[model samples]
Target chain A: MPAIVTTGITKSFGAGETRTSVLRGVDFEAEAGEMTFLVGPSGCGKTTFISILSALLSADGGALSVFGTEPNRLKSGDLVRFRRDMVGFVFQQFNLLPALDAAENVAVPLIIQGVSPRKARQRACAWLELLGLGAHLGKLPSELSGGQQQRVAIARALIHEPRLLVCDEPTASLDAETGRQVIELLREVSLNPERAAIIVTHDDRIYPYADRIAFMADGRLTHVERPDPARIPARPIRGETQP
Target chain B: MLGIALKMLFGDIVKMLGLVMGIAFSTLLMAQQGGFFIGLISRAANTVTEAQGVAIWVMDPKTETAEGPTAMRDVELYRVRGVEGVRQASPLVQATTTLRTPQGRSSAAAFLGVDDASLLGINPRFVVGSPEDLRRPDAIALDQLGFSRLWPGEPLATGKEIEVNDRRATVVAITEALPGFTAPVIVYTRLSQALSYVPGGRNRLSFILVEAEPGRDPRAIAQAISAQTGLLALTTPEFQRRTIDYVLNNTGIAPSFGVVIALGAVVGILVTGLTFTLFVNDNLKQFAVLKAMGLSNWRLLGMVLAQALVVAFIGYAIGLWIASGFFDAVNQPFSDLKGFWLPWQIAVMVAGATAVIVSLASLIAIRRVLRLDPATVFRG
Candidate 1:
């Protein structure tokens, strides 16, 4: 089964006689171990789609299931636990808590899951090292470079080993080279047999990292494109890569 | 979570300091005023309380003590002794007399004509002479405070001569520090001597002092004395209530303190409420961030309340400390004046008021926080 599936999902803001639809019968899926890319112009409902898929927004109609569990059926506390335990989100602006250092930001998911600070920090440090950010763990978000902060955001998203990783324009704020590096990290983290990732971005530079690319326009998926294996060679997989 | 709450609380230290100061000033005022008011009430009753060993006092049925004189039959002591639980009854003539002093003659002195046996009601703190000094026909015992007022720098020696109501009397023994509200008391001989100096009607004594058997109710003795003697007999508590009623009805203290207490409470509510409202407004964004970070609505409320509690506690501590020092320093030389007492109940009241004011102030900010969109955190 796919890691995430949304069938004919729709969302609207406001009520009775004053409503505007943001998403219209959107159907999408992210298979395990695949890096899926969602590319669309602004206001195309890409971000809203990711929000729904991550259970942050309730669908106005139809259904959304993450890892076979219907997101809306979970109780509030169970929903929080589900989000904390099974999903990791990376935002475009690198939304790190200003009061916390880089390692603390990365450990947020584990902390939300009630892990001890020491163990959370240990896990955060390991992920930071994996993302080539070991030396930047102690620096606050304000003290880090834009690229370094984005790498911290990436590390945070992957630190808890969430079953599905969701990114909303994660590289839209970074330079081309930095954006490529982030895309590489997302691809590597999602390559594990038990995990999947869906990244929504306007930037085209990260397209090469996706196993399958879906294009969205005016709140609808227009096309799906698989990577051209002939144009780029795949590297020897490490960690828990899928077969 | 507690750490998060503490860090958030301390993040706006300046605003919190303002809140603390406001609460502290109000709490201190409340504690001090309440303590003083209670102390004043106790003082009004101190005349009876300090002489709690005396079971009953027989007075003219017209009014309470400290009013005008209450003349009762001088022979009523015999009738009082006949009652059950009656141990002894002593007749004393209490009158206000003038004392001639070097500085000038002072008026409104409380002169008591007591036999040696009736000295049981006098507080032993009266230092200059023992109760036996009243045994001499011409002897008088002047309180040490009264002695200071009378003689000034001169030594209060035994056999020193002083005038009472223009009648010559010798200070056979000088008692120490016993100043009553009506006058500075000078204990002299029995009803005859007191009448000779300040003569009133015949066969009348100012009041009768009654003692009862151990564990006997003073109330029962007082009732019996009134039934038999046809005079107003009062237990210590009854007399104290009468004294309080006199003070409340006659003195300006109750209204004055009432106004002050009311103003303190109003100022506390307004100042604390306004200051806390401003503080919450200043930190609304931080509250939004916390809410977005998955803190429940109740948890967010707890955080604001925690801040309020910390402010109230710290302010109360500082205010009470200062009030205690001020009360002690001011009432020190005048030891007769009782100092303020900040009991736990008053502390709780002050703290609780502060918390309520702060919580009311935070309602607007809490509403704003609960409505925040976590999606906004992604926007910027």
Candidate 2:
């Protein structure tokens, strides 16, 4: 089974006279061990599509199945548990809780998964170390540079070893060099045979790192492509489960 | 989670400080008013309470203690002794006498005249002179407080002469500090000397004091006395209640304290509610962040309620401290006003009231937090 499948998903904001459709008949899928990219200009519904895939927004019309379970069919509490257990999200703005230190921010996913704080901190520290952020674990988000904050966000996304990682413009706020480093980290995380990542980005500089790239126009995906193998290096999967 | 709640509660020191002060002031006012009211009520009954071994007080049916004079026949003393529980009974005369003093003929003095045998019912702690001193035909025991007013600069020596009812009487001994209704008191001879001062014949007395058998209920003995003699017999509590009822019905004290107590309660509820409301509003963003982190609505509410509890407890402590200082500095002089005495139960009640007020104030903010869309954090 695919890591994520959405058939004929549609969404609209407001109601009646003021209703405006933001997504229409969007069908998408991401395979295991693949780094799929959704590239589009501003206001093209790339972020909205990722939101639905991450279970943060409910599609008005769709069959959304992540890891063979329908997200919309779950109750409120169960939906939260499902999202915490099955998905990790990295946003464009690096939405780290400002009051928490870097390690605490990275531990949030594990906290949501009901891990004890001590165990969660240990796991988060390991991820931060893997992401080259070991020295900055004790600093707060405000104290870190943009590049360091993005790395912390990336560490948080992969801390719980979620089956599917949904990232919305994960590298948009970083410089080209820092953005490339972040993309490479995401690419390495997606090398697991049973885990996948769907990243939404407007920046074209990081497209070479994507295993498969899907282009979106307006509210629809218009094309898909495989990046040149020479431009991307093979990476060893460090934290994936064997299936 | 509770630790998180405490951190949230104390994180904003300014708002927390405001809430503490508000609650503290309310509690302090409540404790002060309640204590003073009780102390004032106790003063009206002190005269009767100090008289020991008197189980039943016989007063006229139409008379209430402290309201007006109650006259009973001196002959009723014999009838009261005829009851089963009654061991002895005595006729006592209470009259207000004017004494010529350095303070321009001092105000009316509470004069008690009792037979030599019944004088033991008076305060045993009489300072300098014994009750036997009042047995002398021309002698009287003056209260210690009375001498300061009567003599002013003169020393309170034994056998100092004072004019009572324009008749010269020697102060045989000075009694301890026993203040009476309206002013300090003097104890004089009961049989012939006391009756001669009254306008009527010596056969008339103010009231009869009845002593009952050991282990007898005062109320029951009072009923027995009232049944045999056609008079109203009252226990100590009943007498006190009658006096309090008379004062409340006849004086302005009830209305004044009643209004103050009511205002205090209203201000307490409003101030606490408003303070807590502003506190919650200020933390709305923090609440939204917590809600977005998958915290249930009930957990968030618990945190807010915990904050309120901490504020109330701290406030109550400070308020009590302030009230005690006020009482020590002011209230004890005019009346026998005592310090604030708060029981554990009363503290719990105050805390419960504070919690209720805080919970109501938090409802609006809690609803807002629960309804917050987690997606907003992503929007900006």
Candidate 3:
């Protein structure tokens, strides 16, 4: 079974004369152990679709299931719990809380899950170290570079060890080299046989890092593209990659 | 989540301090103005407090305050003295007259008349001379406060004669007494001497100060005095309330102080409320992110309330400290602001106002955070 499956998911905004549809019958699936990329131009409903899959937004119409549970059918409170316990999100702007140091920011998900703060910080420290941010754990978001900030956001997303990790243009803020380093880091640290990573991006530079890329337009999935077999990495990356 | 809320609130040092200052000023305004009002009104009961030996105060039905007591028939004292629990009932005279110093500077002075033999209504600690000295010709025992007004910066030495209502009045002794509301300096004299100074009819007795026998309830004795003499009677506490009530209802004092106290609360609420709302609106995106992170609207509301609570707690403590210090600075017994105290009610008032200001100020923020679009995090 796919980690996330959406059939005929529809969403719209506004009302009356100004009403506009954003998503029209988009069917998508993200597979476990693979980093699936949902790539589209601005206003293509990529965020909305991933938001539905993450249980952050309810689709106006759909049959949506995240890890065999239909998020659309869950109660509002249970939907929040589903999002908190089963999914993690990485935003495009690297939305780390400016007040907290990297370790505290990464510990947010665990704290929300009722983990003791000391244990949460320890787990956050381990994850931050895994993402090559061990030395920067005490630095605030403003004190770090954009690349370091994005790594912190990634660490926050992965800290709770959710089955499905969702990224909204996670590398959108980084430079060419930094974006490559972040995508490679995500591929190495997040994806496994039991857990999956889904990224929404239009950055052609990071396309090779994704196992598959879904292209969208006008709120509908156009097609999915895969890398040439010869260009694929010989094996998955498991540890730190120097930028 | 609570930790995150706290971090977010304190992260912006300037904003947090601004919020705390707003709350603190509000608390200070309410507490301090209320203290002054409390201090001012409590002065109306100065004479009642000065008469320590009197447990029950008997006056005419028309009399509302000690300062405005109408003279009752002298025979009324005999009726009050006849009451069952009354150990003694003294005919007390209270009148305000002008005291002309030797230098020709004249100021209003209150004269308290007591029974010469018993000295029931005019008990005070003597600074110079003795109570018996008042029996001398035209002699008066002046309060230390009155002594200062009569002869400014003069020592407590006796034989300082001053004109009372254009007649010779000698300051035979100096007695330290908290100044009365009508005048800072009060003259303690015999009942006949007080009656001679003020022009009046046969009924010159202002009050019949009664003492309840040992172990007797003053409230019951007061009731018996009123029923027997057909006069209004009140225990000390009840008389104090009557005095305060008279000031509140008849004079411009209540409205004057009420406006200031109410204005302080209004301005505090507006300022703190606006600042709190502005702070939340400025960080709308952060709330959106939290919402996107699956925080419930209830949790979001709790976060804003928590921020409000921190501000209220810090502000109230600091504001009350300053208000208490203000009271300390103005509490001069020799001056007119005697008997001024910040009661616990004022603290409760400040705390109650703080809670209200916090809740009102955070209402908009709470509503906005509750309705925030979690999808807004996707924009920009």
Candidate 4:
């Protein structure tokens, strides 16, 4: 089964004359073991769609499902649990708290899972080590380079081993090389047959990292394209699971 | 989760101090000033405090305060003595007179007369000559506080001489006596000598101090004395309360302290309210981020309360310590702050008030945060 499925989803803001539709009757789906890129112009509904899928926003109508559970059917508490246990998020701002060191920031998800603090920190350290950040585990977000900070954000998102990861313009603030490194890290560390990752970006330079790039405009999904490995210089996938 | 909340609270060092200081200042001011007010009112009853062996007081019907100099006829003492349950009745006199300084300067002095045989009303504590020295001819025992008030530069000695009511008098002893709000210069002399020093026509007895016999109720004896003698007879505790009540009602001291203490609480609330709201605004985005991470609203409320508790505990502890330190520094036997104390009742009251102030400030900020959409982070 697909990791996420949205059928005729609709979301709007304001009332009467000032009313505007941000997402209008959109149907979209994302599969497991793949990185799906959502892209379009700035005012397109890319962020609105990503927010709805991340369970941060409620859809005005239609059905949405993640891991075969329809979100609209879940109560508020169950929805919170679903998001907590199954979904993770990465932000463009690298929203790692400046007050916490990299390891502690990554440990937040496990802490929220009611894991013991010592064990959670140990798991966080292990994850940071896997990403080559063992020497910088104690550095705060402000003290790290852009690529390292993004790596910490990715570690935080994957720490609880959530099945679906949604990233919003994750490389928007980094330079080209750092952005490439961060995208490669996400691709290397997150995709698997039982899990999926989504990146919403306007950076065409990172397009080769996605298995499929979906185009959005005027709150509607218009097209999706798969890159040809024989044609593009994009690194071909070597495995279906995280290393 | 609580660790994150605490880290957020303590990381902002400047604002955390601002919050703690606001509550601490209010607590300190309320406790310290309240102690002084209590001390001042207690001093209004200094006459009753110094008369140790007497349990009942007989004064004129119209006398309302402890320091009122309503005189009674000399025969009234015998009448009070005849009351049932009265073990020993002493005719006591408390009157104000003037002492003439060597420079011809005059200041009002409190003239106190005791029973010549027993000296029952004299303060037992003395710093210079003994109590017997007060019995010599034209001899007087002036309190060290009075000596200092009457002669600011003079040394406390046994031989200083002053003129009372233009008559020759000598300070034969220096005794320890707490200065009262009404009478700062206290002079203890014999009843006959005070009669000469203070001029009163036909009525010289200021009060008939009575001691009830053992196994007898003083209140019943006081009532019988009042009914038989047509004078106001009151137990010591009752008279002390009346004096304190007089100070509270007739003087503005009670309301004045009340206004200051009330202002302290209000200022505490305002300081915390403004700063906490500002802190919330600065961290609003972070709250949205937390909410987006699926932290339930209930858990967020817990985090807010945890922060408030931490601030309240630190602030209240420091405020209490500083007030205690200040009281220890200034409290002395004869100083203005004598009998001053930060009572535990007042401390508990201040603590309750501090909790209220802290809770109100935190709840106001939390209300705004709870209504925010976690999706707001998507926009910013």
Candidate 5:
């Protein structure tokens, strides 16, 4: 079964004359154990579609399911629980809280789930150790470089072990080499038979890592294709499971 | 999460200082003004409070306060003394006169003339000399503040000669008395000398200070005296309360203090509300990111409340410390503000006001948070 499946997902903003349609109808699917990249020009409704898929937003009209559960039909409380237990997100800004150290920032999800803070920090430390950030765990986001901050954001997203990871423009702020490294780390640690990852990006340098690429323009998915396998780099997998 | 909230608030030093200062200034102004008002109003009843054993005060029906009395005929004293439950009735006179120091300086002074034999209404805590010293010829007792004002550099000692209403008077004792609202200089002398010194009509007795029998209720005795003698009579507490009420209702002191206190609260509310709102707005994006991470709106509300409470508590503590310190410094001996103090009730009142301030500010700021769209995090 697909990890996420949506048909005719629609959303709009404002009212009366100023009503702007950002997502007319978006139909998309991603199976478990695969990395699907949504590629499009700016304002193509790519972010809105992922937001709907992850339950960060509600669709004006659509049928949506994540891992056999339809989110729109769930009660408000149930929907919040679903988002908390099943979804993870990474933003383009690497939005680590400026006041918190790296480990504390990465510990946010588990803390939100009501885990003891001491244990959350322990788990966060293990994740940081796996992602080559063990030396930077005590440093705040502003104390680290762009690549390091993005790594901390990725650690925060995956620390809860959610089945569906959604990342929007995760590498747009990094250089080519560091961006490729982050994507490599995200896939090696996040993909398995029980989980899937979806990344929204306009950065073409990381395109070879996507198993399937969906193109969006003008509020709909225009095309979906399998990328050439030869262009993908083969590297030994590391940090495949929770440390 | 609450821990995170506190960390967030304390992380910005300049903003935290601004918030603390707003609350502190409000509290200080409120407490200080309230203390001053209480101290000043209490002075209106100082004579009543200082008269230790006088249970009932008998005056002319038109006399409302202790400051200015309509003199009753000397025969009215005998009438009050004949009332049932009146153990001892003594004639007490209150008058104002001008005093001239040996240095040739002059100032107005409040005069109290007690019964010469019993000295029933002249009870005072002596500061420098014994009460026995007032028994000497032409002797008078001066309040410590008055002595300091009349002789700025002179030590408080006996054998200081002064003139009252052109009559020679000597300061034989220095007594500690609560300063009055209008006159800080208080002079205590015998009834014969006060009548001889001040120019007045044939009626000389200002009040009859009646001490009720041990088992008698002072209020009942006062009522009996009033009914039989055709004079206004009141228990000590009643007279004190009436005096304070007269000061509050008939004077501008209460309104003046009230305006200042109201302005302090207003300034505190405005400063704290605006600064707190700005603080939240600056961190709005961070809050949105938390919301998008599956934190419930309820938990987010709790976090905001936690931040607000922390600020209020810290600010209130600092303000209260400073205000109490002011009261302590002024309450020293020889200071004109010797009787002023910060009451715990005022602290509690300021605390309640602080709560209202923070709640209003948090309500305004949290509306923005509650209405925030978590999807906006994706926009950045």
Candidate 6:
């Protein structure tokens, strides 16, 4: 079964003459156990589509389900819980709180779910260690480099073991080498038969890591493609890739 | 979440201090102004409070305050002594006179003439000499403030000669007395000596200090005294309230202090509210990120409120400490500010006002956070 499936989802902004429709009846699907990339130009509704898919936003009209549960039908409170327990997000800018050290930033989702801070931080420490950030757990986001910050964002996203992980230009801020390492880490640590990731990206360098890629344009899903097997890297994408 | 909220608030040390200072400034203004006002008005009743063991006062029916009493006939003192429950009724005089130093300078002084035998009204906390020394020939006790006025820069001593209305009066003792509303200096002398200093008719009695018989209610005794003598008689606390009420109702002191207190609250709200809003505006992206992470609007609101309360607590504590220190530093034996105090009641009331200021200030920041959309995090 697919982790998320949407049919004829639509969304818009403003009202009357000023209103601009951002999503025009889009249909899409992301199956479990694989990475799906939503790629398009700016203003093409890629971020808006992922926003709705992760329950950060609601579609004006849609039939939407993640892991067999319809998100569009959930009440306000239930939708919050649905997002808290099932979805993880990594932003292009690596939206880690400036005041929080790495471990505290990574512990946020579990803390949101009423986990004691000490235990949440313990789990966060383990995750950061797994991502080669064990020594940097006490460092604030400002003290981190781009690659280090992105890894912290990934650890934060995966800390609660959510069923769906969403990334919006996660490596857009990193250099080519760091971007490849971050994508390899995501592939190794986040993808499994019970969970999936959907990345919205403008960077094509990390394109081969996705199992399926959906292209969006003018608020519509224009096409879907699977990367050629020979083009996909057979070896580890970087030397320091985590297990 | 709460920890995150506090960490976020304290992350910017400058803004947090600005917030704390806003609250502290207002708290200090309200509390300090309130204490001074209370101290100023209470001076009007200082005479009533200082009459130590006197339980009731019997005066002319028109006498409205301790500072200005309409003289009653000396017979009225005897009449009050005859009332039921009257243990003893002593003649007490209240009047203001000019005192001249040997240096030929002068300041207006509040003059009290106590009973020749009992010295009922002028209960002095002596700084030098003894109360018994008042019985010496041509002797008078000068208050510490009055002595400073007459003999500037001189150490307190007995036997300082001062002139009261051209009468040679020797200050045989220096006494500690609360500064009064009409004058800073106080002179205590025998009734006969006081009568010699002030020019008035044969009816020289100002007020009759009454001590109720043991186990008798002073309020009821006061009522009996008023009924028997057709004078206004009041228990000590009742008379103190009457005197303070007269000042509060008749003078602009209350409203002047009131304006300052109100301005304190307004300034607190403006400073705290504007700073908190700016702080929240600066951290808008962070709040949006939290919102996107599945935190509810209610939780976000709580975080803002918690941040506000922390600022309020620290600011109020700092303000209270400074205000209390002001009261402590000046309320000394000879300081003109001796009678002023920060009442715990005023402290508590200011705290309540601080809470109100913080809540009003937090509203702006809270509104911004609540109206924020989580998708803004995705935008960047």
Fnat measured on candidate 2: 0.13
The per-residue C-alpha lDDT of model 5 at residue B290 equals: 85
Q: Candidate 1: lDDT of B170? A: 76
Query: Candidate 2's error at B54, in angstroms?
Result: 3.6
Error of 2 at B174 (Å): 8.7
lDDT of 5: 0.88
Which has the higher DockQ value, candidate number 3 or candidate number 4?
A: 3
For residue A229, model 6's alpha carbon misses the true position, in angstroms, by 2.0
Inter-residue clash pairs, candidate 5? none
TM-score of 3: 0.93
lDDT of 2 at B101: 48
Model 4 TM-score, 2 decimals: 0.92
Docking class of 4: medium
Candidate 6 residues B1-380, lDDT tens each? 89999999999899999999999999999999999999999899998888878999888988889999999998888888888899999998889989987889788988899999988877668888877788888899888887776777888898778787778999998888888999877888898888998878877788999988999999999998888879999999999999999999999999999999999999999999999999999999998888888899999999999999999999999999999999999887677787889999999999999999999999878999999988888986
- RMSDs, each prediction? 5.2, 5.2, 2.6, 2.8, 1.8, 2.0
What is candidate 6's lDDT per residue for A14-94, written digit by digit as tens? 999999999999999999878899999899999888889888889999799899988888998888898889999999999
State candidate 5's TM-score: 0.96
Deviating ranges (above 4 Å) for candidate 2: A32-51, A89-158, A164-236, A240-243, B48-50, B65-69, B90-116, B120-207, B245-271, B324-336, B343-345
* Model 6 ranges with Cα > 4 A deviation: A235-243
lDDT tens digits, residue span A89-111, model 4: 88888777767889998988888
**DockQ scores of the candidates:** 0.21, 0.25, 0.66, 0.59, 0.73, 0.78
Is 2 or 6 the stronger prediction by TM-score?
A: 6
Clashing pairs in 4: none
Regions more than 4 Å wrong, model 4: A230-243, B97-109, B127-130, B147-157, B167-176, B184-187
lDDT of 2 by residue, B1-380 (tens): 45456655676677788878777777776667765665565556666766767777887776677325577776777888788888778777777777764335564577766765666346666667777777776777776666766665566666877667767667877766345545444454554566665456544677777787898887998987788787899987788788777777777876787677557656766877787778777666556544544555666677777777787778878877776666667542122232224445545655565566556655666676677665554564
After superposition, which runs of candidate 3 have C-alpha atoms over 4 Å from their true positions?
A: A233-243, B123-138, B147-160, B172-176, B215-217
Ranking by DockQ: 6, 5, 3, 4, 2, 1
Score every model by TM-score.
0.77, 0.78, 0.93, 0.92, 0.96, 0.97
Q: How should the candidates be ordered by TM-score, best one leading?
A: 6, 5, 3, 4, 2, 1
What digit string (tens of lDDT, one per residue) describes model 1 on residues B1-380? 44445555665678778877877788778777877776676555554665536778777788566435577665677777788887877776767767775446564567766645566555555456766766777677766666656665676567777676678777777654334555534354555577777767775576677888888888988898889878888987788788788878888888888788767767766777787777776666555444444445666677777777777778778877877776666553224453345566766776676666556656665666666555554565
The CAPRI-style docking tier of model 3 reads medium
| Tens-place lDDT digits, model 3, residues B287-328 | 887777767788888888888898889888888888888778
